[model samples]
Target chain A: MGTEDDVTPVARPGRPYDRSRDAQILAVTLDALAEREYEHVTIDAVAQRAGRAKTTLYRRWPTKVDLVLAAVEAAGRPPEADELPDEGTLRADLLAVVDSPWLGGPERRLAIFTGLTSAARSSDRLADAVRTTVTEPYVAVYRALLQRAVDRGQVAAELAPRVPLLAQVIPAMSGHRLGATGEPAGREFFVSVVDQVVLPALAHPPGPATPA
Target chain B: MGTEDDVTPVARPGRPYDRSRDAQILAVTLDALAEREYEHVTIDAVAQRAGRAKTTLYRRWPTKVDLVLAAVEAAGRPPEADELPDEGTLRADLLAVVDSPWLGGPERRLAIFTGLTSAARSSDRLADAVRTTVTEPYVAVYRALLQRAVDRGQVAAELAPRVPLLAQVIPAMSGHRLGATGEPAGREFFVSVVDQVVLPALAHPPGPATPA
Candidate 1:
């Protein structure tokens, strides 16, 4: 439904690319994703919401996948610092990740998650974006947490390789539930994951170190 | 792409609804979903692939979500017997579910999964289909397995309510990995889930009957 009438000039040309407008487009795009399902959302809708031209959005992101990926990559900014406060045991540390505002809790995060999975299934750009922007940073935090647990003798050294995949579990589970209900998973759901899944996986007894 | 030239007209009315044509449509739809990502896939495309008119396919399923849901429900028919061989422990039972041919292995299953998750985010019909066709049955089998584990005192009786969510863990993990790599998670990935995630979550020291 893009018409010339719908195309608002994004400021006269040569007037500094207006980085704020790009940010505005990304923000509206994310809001659109959160408010509607991926397939139902359109770039025209985003442009309308952002008060920009469809041509302006098309110039930056040629397709919906490109736009969605840019938004997801934009949303997944690494926390300013890596060293978390000593949250006592590994359970608390892991729980802190879940409890954190950023780690897959918000409605917008779910939107990015749903879009990422759908796009990454076919697009290499999104797949790489998922790996670099979403996967690696999350895994790094998990690895560091598990190492701390190992040093404290809470988790076994043998479970090292397996710990990284654990990083994906809670987010995946939350993402799964969110797809159905369009709401972030509750605290109880996360508590079950930590109490039942993560801690259980790592509770290797101290005797006869069985290699994981 | 759907054209009268390509259309294989369904048998005229009063004759049985071409049951085989229905099957062909479902099969081609599944193929279409696997061959392309969810958004790019269309009813016309599926109809074209099945060599049937779009009207014929539309008669059976009104919208793309309906068509996709039908294809998913068709793909996920769990053969009626549920009495699993008691593999002596919860670990073995869980492994059997993961190892089952119908569970987490097929390309069509992944396609259905991707399509369902993508569509379900907004459509209640797709969401319910996913819960019933995709999530519940799998959860039922897992609940049965865990029940057996509890019967043998291998699992904590207190963890019953949480068991169903645990059932989602393996499929969710595999789904996440599949979305990125577009490949079914290998045997090793399922194994890690059972060992590291499920087992640990249920690992209660066989001491007192402490209620969870």
Candidate 2:
């Protein structure tokens, strides 16, 4: 998997640490986290895999939780508000998120999520980290997308308030699939969820305007 | 928490086993499971807690996985189709499921789910057990409820085909909450999901009939 990107050193402020070096180590950490339970993932192993000294990892992250959280945060970079896909229709906009890089591919991302979720079950800090890094960013992106649709008159203005909850539908289902089945939900499943659940819910909100 | 029901031994066929005794043991197992991870739950501890001999417990359930699977199955008895809530509205009927005994109360059910889900993340056997014991039954109940609505002309007939997929929304979200935060998704949260997501999705499914 080594490419020219692995050799390219991106600049960062505050310290002399190379951003690409941090990215490289974090990527390795994520791969290890994806493969095994959190307790089983040792910093020594990550350092070895990343071709860095264990002391260097300790100097950077100090704790396994810190390292893991950093890796998760790095990998889960949701598209910025300006970067959201605008495919004209609300459905298309949402569908675009299914394959978005922020989600990663089906295999690695779900495995990483499964590992982190299992860890989160015992540690409140890890749970909070996941909510902040993984869930919230995705939720924000969805809310932004939904807001865009609302502004364009693609979705009802009355449904605007529900953007927060509605945004969670896909992420919740994806989380559930990994937790319950220990497998990644594929594109077809996401499509089914968006089409059969999310869109329908948006279209048929039980508001004052609805008939009894 | 001990009651007269704990002392009552309901009769069961085969090997002269008492149904109530089995129920009592399973309840204890569920409680322990709720309190900690699956790997930490020992048969000897369960036997001691249940007031049964270790030999007796071994004779019945042979392994930890077997015992756990049995306990989960015993707890998750979805109501019969005829027993579904007929509140005369699809929304009310769906909401009634939130408070159903089969789901248990918020605390115990969610905790048990978190434990099972964490275990499921590592074991395909446990994952399958959860699907069979917990998820499938709930899905069936939801499908039945939705079908009942269709029969009553409450939900559109065209939405019948998506019943199975639609039935999964609440369970998936609930599963996500436990897995991500190790917390029960509260009644308020369930209400929001139903009002904002499930019902709306049912009303607005994507089909050929939908306007471009």
Candidate 3:
């Protein structure tokens, strides 16, 4: 097993570099990850595939977890608020998100989660980095989309306030599908959750029902 | 590293045995897990603590993952449907599940999941065993409880049918809390998820909104 001493050294300020080296390294990491599980993917292998020196790889990432996280970060673009579709409804926007190739794909989500699980187990700093870099940004984009729907009266006003619920449920749904079936997420999964589960709970405000 | 040969032997039909030996062994397994993370909880240590022969332990379980999973199984009783509180309300029944001492405690749940993560990485057999023995049974209880509530007309009739949603979301919520906070799960976390997230999602029947 490689240890802390195996980390690559950082590049010096004066050295000339290939501009695409970072992308090359990241692409190699994804390919290796897809081919094997997280534990099997190593810095040496990534460097070998990228055709870059091990020292150069280490110069950029202090640990293998860091390298894997960087690769995960590079795998997909974060969901953007402006990119959200306006079908004149909150449900449509949610459908759009669930249906998007980014959230819906199995391999892509698994690749990201594999890095996350490794980081969560091995190092606290890496765990925090993953949360901020991968989890939070996507959650923020979803929340903003929901908030926009609320502002437009597409959804109830009170619905926008429950950030934690959306944050927790969406990922849980995806993770559950992955854990059980290892299949890509689908729009019906999200729509069922939002319509059959989320919407009804939100429809009635948080007070006692009126007397019959 | 104790390999496959390190396992203790199982009890045979003709063998003289201590009736309390199984309990003692399981207790030692829990103690070892609590003191050390799953990776460090060796069969040797468990054998030493239980004053049992290594071959005996190995005979019972061929792998460390099996041993650890057995310990988790012995730690808590399966949730029983008869034990569920039925106040004739969906919220109340869900809240009872949320507040279940076995499910709500962080250390126990975390330890169980830690073992699961390791098993998921190392052995497919262990993973399947865990899913069948632990996850499936617990889900069955919850599903039964929901079915009861639906029959009572407390929850929407259609809401009880989404097994995949319920099966995935509840554990995912608990796992997410443990991953994020590194703390025990609490009643508030469970209540918020059920009321704000799960109940609403379930209560809402899936449909397209009428053109406003």
Evaluate model 2: give its lDDT.
Answer: 0.72
lDDT of 3 by residue, B83-172 (tens): 766655656666566555563354555454554545544456656666665666666667777777677766667556664466466766
For candidate 3, the per-residue lDDT at B128 reads 65
Q: Interface RMSD values for the candidates, listed in order?
A: 3.7, 2.8, 3.0
| TM-score to true structure, per model | 0.67, 0.69, 0.71
**Candidate 1 deviant stretches above 4 angstroms:** A1-15, A20-70, A80-85, A101-131, A204-212, B1-15, B18-71, B80-85, B101-131, B204-212
lDDT of 1 by residue, A66-112 (tens): 98787766665445126663676666666666556663354445455
- What's the C-alpha lDDT at position B197 in model 2? 72
TM-score of chain B of each: 0.70, 0.76, 0.68
lDDT of 3 by residue, A127-201 (tens): 676666666665666777667756876567766666556656665666556555555355456666665554444
Model 2 lDDT per residue over B50-122, tens place: 9999998898899988888777666655554338887766777776777665435655666777778766655
RMSD to the hidden true structure, all candidates = 8.9, 7.4, 8.5
DockQ of 3: 0.40
How many clashes in each candidate? 3, 5, 22
Q: How far is A200's C-alpha from truth in model 1 (Å)?
A: 1.9
lDDT of residue B68 for candidate 3: 71
